[model samples]
Target: MWELRHRGGGGPGPGGEAASPPREGEAAGGDHETESTSDKETDIDDRYGDLDSRTDSDIPEIPPSLDRTPEILKKALSGLSSRWKNWWIRGILTLTMISLFFLIIYMGSFMLMLLVLSIQVKCFHEIITIGYRVYHSYDLPWFRTLSWYFLLCVNYFFYGETVADYFATFVQREEQLQFLIRYHRFISFALYLAGFCMFVLSLVKKHYRLQFYMFAWTHVTLLITVTQSHLVIQNLFEGMIWFLVPISSVICNDITAYIFGFFFGRTPLIKLSPKKTWEGFIGGFFSTVIFGFIAAYVLSKYQYFVCPVEYRSDVNSFVTECEPSELFQLQSYSLPPFLKAVLRRETVSMYPFQIHSIALSTFASLIGPFGGFFASGFKRAFKIKDFANTIPGHGGIMDRFDCQYLMATFVHVYITSFIRGPNPSKVLQQLLVLQPEQQLNIYKTLKTHLTEKGILQPTLKV
Candidate 1:
């Protein structure tokens, strides 16, 4: 076995440095030594050990100093904290948006109804211009102004009666013509003829194709407005419900979309609207259904106000006094046996008011969102960020009213088709059958009798 010698100080003969050679019995000790040459250099006591022995006081000592933070670093950290504190700002923004939304709904309810009518008129005018553009390839100076006046007349002719009837007492005597000739009919015809002449004249100007298109577009627009207007008016959906359904549906859809988008919106639904997601669509769909049900329930409860019930007593009395002309229409009409018996008993109840809530909801959900989608597509097509930045975090009039337009038309159609009972003539016949005029006379007679007997107060109408 090799032996190893321990080298503490100078042991080598050549340079007086430590270099102990391995001995036969110490070879295992050399193998076990793991310290490298670099470790030996870093050991501080190696050189000092060769010097004369020194006391502990011979070395100088240094004390530790405090660490100082930079002012710029402190400011940077503060800024990061402030930037992250956005909760309060977000809350304030949300509240403001909600308040403005309700305010718009309140004022816009009536304004939107007017807007719908106006859009129809304007769209009609645009269509006429489209025709002129197609046929003549350019606009006539007076065409716009003339179209406005023409559309106004047509609107007044169709809508004036129903709108005036809403506030019947405010209506002037001259506005009460139900069956009078429409004075603007000739002007309307003349405008159409003039447009035709303009189209023909364009042929002389080498723009016949454009002029033909202009006339064609004008007529097409006119037809569209006429059809839509007829549908809306005939349905008798001009009241507050017109505003409520659309507004409610849009609001509900928006809210539900937000809720779902916030929670589960991991994937985008469409590239055009990146924020829209499958989660949001599902949420909106369910929310729309809920709103529909609520609207139906509320409308049903208030059906009496929307559509009043007319009661009839004593069929014999009604028939005896009803006009011969009215009797012809009443011939096929008869009340249920039970209801007739109840009417004969002079009961107050005859017809219970009914409202179609489910129908209203179905229409709102199906048609309302299409309006929104179309508006979205329109914005995408135009390459616009939004309609306008009028409402913070929201968009413009077109953006807000998109869904409303479709919803209004849908509910109006539903009400017209199913909710409104039979014709007015039938109702009038039933009222006449009760001998309303005779009953009024008898009532007046009783009133006089009661006054003479000191049982009632007498009053005179001016």
Candidate 2:
């Protein structure tokens, strides 16, 4: 009994000399010859018990359960295999989501901004939840609170910038908002500093590493969800078509790829996403390019869809009306000789946006899936089948939007690179924010330049 106690108690050896702790390379042992092994392990456990207990958080092994068919559908399609059942569930939900999306679009730009915010919040929650689950840091003080606090700080910063940039006229009328907008970055930074100080104050000794890990995790999540969602809203303000075409291309690719893969997939595309295939990837690329071209053509014809969302101070509301940009205006393009010979046409008139859509569609098809695959690998790392069970068949909102976020970033980059040019409206918005003296100086400078160019009649000084 004393021997048992000695072995288990992690105490000194029978010899007065203390037992050396087991080497890091050696494993736990059983034989009496190595009786000290168990004692050494016990000593190590005692030394780091607090961390070991929390760090051992492993998700239990469970089979993938992506089916998640709703009860009514399950009962109705009870005869079908799980694969077909999932197909039905996903298809119905996809259409429902698209319909709801159109409804939001009809409700107008404010509603679309709200939708982006909602998705951003949900995605942030899903990712933060995963971090919490992986770390099992429930005992860590103020972590969940800090995560949410940082999220609010980020939203305030991004949305504040959006209002300042896109709603300058509207903001100018509100005194309280004017102050906030004037010093938006400083306020955002102060808010973040408060969160950072709270985090430092909340740190516990044993959980220091884990706490810092969660800190980094929260910031990375904000970068992914908040930053990309802001870019999406920026795309929306460019024109509804700017927002819609890229997103629709991704959706088109995701669906067509899945459908093609379901029917014809053989060679695996990537180890990260086992089900993705070369056949589906190729099919999705062609389908998305076609879909983007057609959608751009259709949307470009409508002033409402093609116009930038702008604040109309006269109407005291936001509006989407302006002369369509060169992008939306139809232009003639000369076909290459071979294409001209094949099609029997020398030139084709098309919206410049339709030509740009080909690039957007190509990225959505070829590169967008990598975003989804990255999410899949993240889940695999954590032994999770899904981010959350929010959507019946879609896993979570993040699952559906992973590729969309990637597409949004790409579109924003593409616009700045190729599509967007100097905007008179944006410059006017900046002028509106200036003091009267500054505005007058700019006006004088502009008038003088215009007079020199003979575009404006010069006023004689009295």
Candidate 2 TM-score versus the reference: 0.86
How many residue pairs clash in all the candidates, one count each? 26, 0
Model 2 bad stretches (over 4 Å): 1-68, 422-435
The per-residue C-alpha lDDT of model 2 at residue 177 equals 85
Q: Write the per-residue lDDT of candidate 1 for residues 249-348, one digit (tens) a residue.
A: 6667766776687678888876657767888877777777777556644543433223322222323110112221211121233557797787774333
What is residue 9's positional error in candidate 2, in angstroms?
A: 16
Cα lDDT tens digits, model 2, 1-462, are 354334333456788767764554453655554656555656654543433343224443334546565678889979989899889888999999999999998999889988999999999999998888666767889999999999999989988877777777677789998888888899999999999999999987666767888899999999999999999999998888989899999999999999999999999999988989999999999999999999989999998889988878888777888888788888999999999989999999998888888999999999999999999988877788888888887898999999999999999998888876776655766788788999999999999999999999989889
Model 1 ranges with Cα > 4 A deviation: 1-143, 146-150, 161-239, 267-275, 298-356, 385-393, 421-462
Model 1 TM: 0.47
TM-score, each model? 0.47, 0.86
How many angstroms is residue 186 displaced in model 1 relative to the true structure, after the best TM-score fit?
6.0
RMSD of 1: 32.8
